[model samples]
Target: MRNQFVGKLVLVAAGIAVLLVLTPFAIVPAGHRGVLTTFGKPSPEVFDEGLHFRWPIAQSMHLVGVAIEKGEGEGDAASKDLQTVKTKVVINYHVRPDAVVAVYRDLGNQPGERIIVPAVHEAVKAVTARYTAEELISKRAIVRNDIVDALRERMARHGLVIDEFSIVSFNFSKTFDEAIEAKTTAEQLKMKAERDLQRIEVEAQQKIARAKAEAESLSLQRQQVTPELLRLRETENQAKAIEKWDGKLPATMAGGAVPFISLPAKQ
Candidate 1:
């Protein structure tokens, strides 16, 4: 009977040891934290990275890695110009270290993908709806910032923090895409035509200025040659001829030729 008692005591001690060993759980690997709960009620005390104890059967712990994670989602949304756009977005985020308890309490286990994807979709829609389809294509960085800001606000309420959010792809409806392309082409053509017209106009003004200068010069030349000016020019020419002539008496005076003297007439 003493041997039987000893055997029973050994069995009891081994079982106790096994229970003790199994009761305490390591929350996660290094760089992680555990959310503890008592009978499904979350406790405010968060367990850091290490082995920790909980009530063997009634209490439990959920481990959440506070490291950043990436998630993606796609959806159709309307732009500010009332055009439908399809967008794919990627988000990088991590559970806020201090908000781990709140995250586990509200979202429970498996919160990473479930909480992030929907929030990203909502934020994308909200921001996309405020911009035009053209703006979404050309100014994607701004759109990304808007989406990030919105996600930050929404995720904050759920005890999540967003590290970065980006728009991976933005697609437009076939009709809209064609229309935008055609519109852009037309605008470029119009600008080119306007430039050409301006160049032609400048050339025309230069020609007009040159023609006016020529006409003025011709008018000045004509004004300098009046009838009165012509008579004075003839008188000067006769005086130059007489001054150049050598004095010699003509035989016409001895042969009864009439003597004559030329004089300028009054104009």
Candidate 2:
């Protein structure tokens, strides 16, 4: 009975030793960092992915992910023309692994909710106010870039890196949309009218050119009609009449007058 009791005591001591040996070691998962805190105070040393050792019951591990994350924000703002604008913003960001401890110490773990959201609103508002509503609609890329630049600098101070940022959407009043549509329609109509006018002008020019050519041809024909040509035409007509006539005089004459003075005195 004494030997059996000693063996049980030895087994109890071995179990306690095993527990002590394994308690200090922790396995930080993939894409995470282990932040160490001793006695409720944060330590400057940060642990990367994989196994790490810490004091039992004295040092605690807090895991934070350093992978890429997405954040969205929206807000109401006024344009440079005092038009009401509603904007939705989207951003991709990630925390710096080495600087995460700084993030936890300075800004705490809710950095995204607390920091990025407000920054997006402010940056969007500030950028939106600089451009007119029409300009905002036309130059959306410029607006997105401005917001990105502003947020990048702001978030970098808190250990958040901006990967990509964009202005997802911008909404304005119904009246503005109608006005744009009407303006586009009017411009198209004006262009059509101008094209019609140009076509008519070209047709008119072609007709004038044809008329001038006809007039030039008529003038050239008139210049060729000389007095000698008229006499030659009359002679040719007399010859054709003589050729077709029989070799005899006319039996009668017109009662009004004779074409020529007869040789009466000689008769």
C-alpha lDDT score of every prediction, in listed order? 0.83, 0.88
- The backbone clash count of each candidate, in order, is 1, 0
Residue-wise C-alpha lDDT for candidate 1, range 1-267, written one tens digit per residue? 999999999999999988864676645567578887777888888788877867776777778778887887789989999998889877788887788887776676555666787877788888888888889988989888888887787788877888877788999889998998999999999999999999999999999999999999999989899999999999999999999888965646757875666689989
User: Where does model 2 exceed 4 Å of error?
Assistant: 1-22, 213-267
* Window of ten residues with lowest summed lDDT in model 2: 258-267
Candidate 2 lDDT, 1-267, residue by residue in tens: 999999999999999987875598878898888789887788888899998888888887888788888888788999999888999878888989988788778878777888998988888889999999989988988888888888889898888999888788898888887888999899999999999999999999999999999999999999999999999999999999999999976655788565666776754
* Residue pairs whose backbone atoms clash in candidate 2: none
- What is the TM-score of each predicted model, taking all chains together? 0.63, 0.71
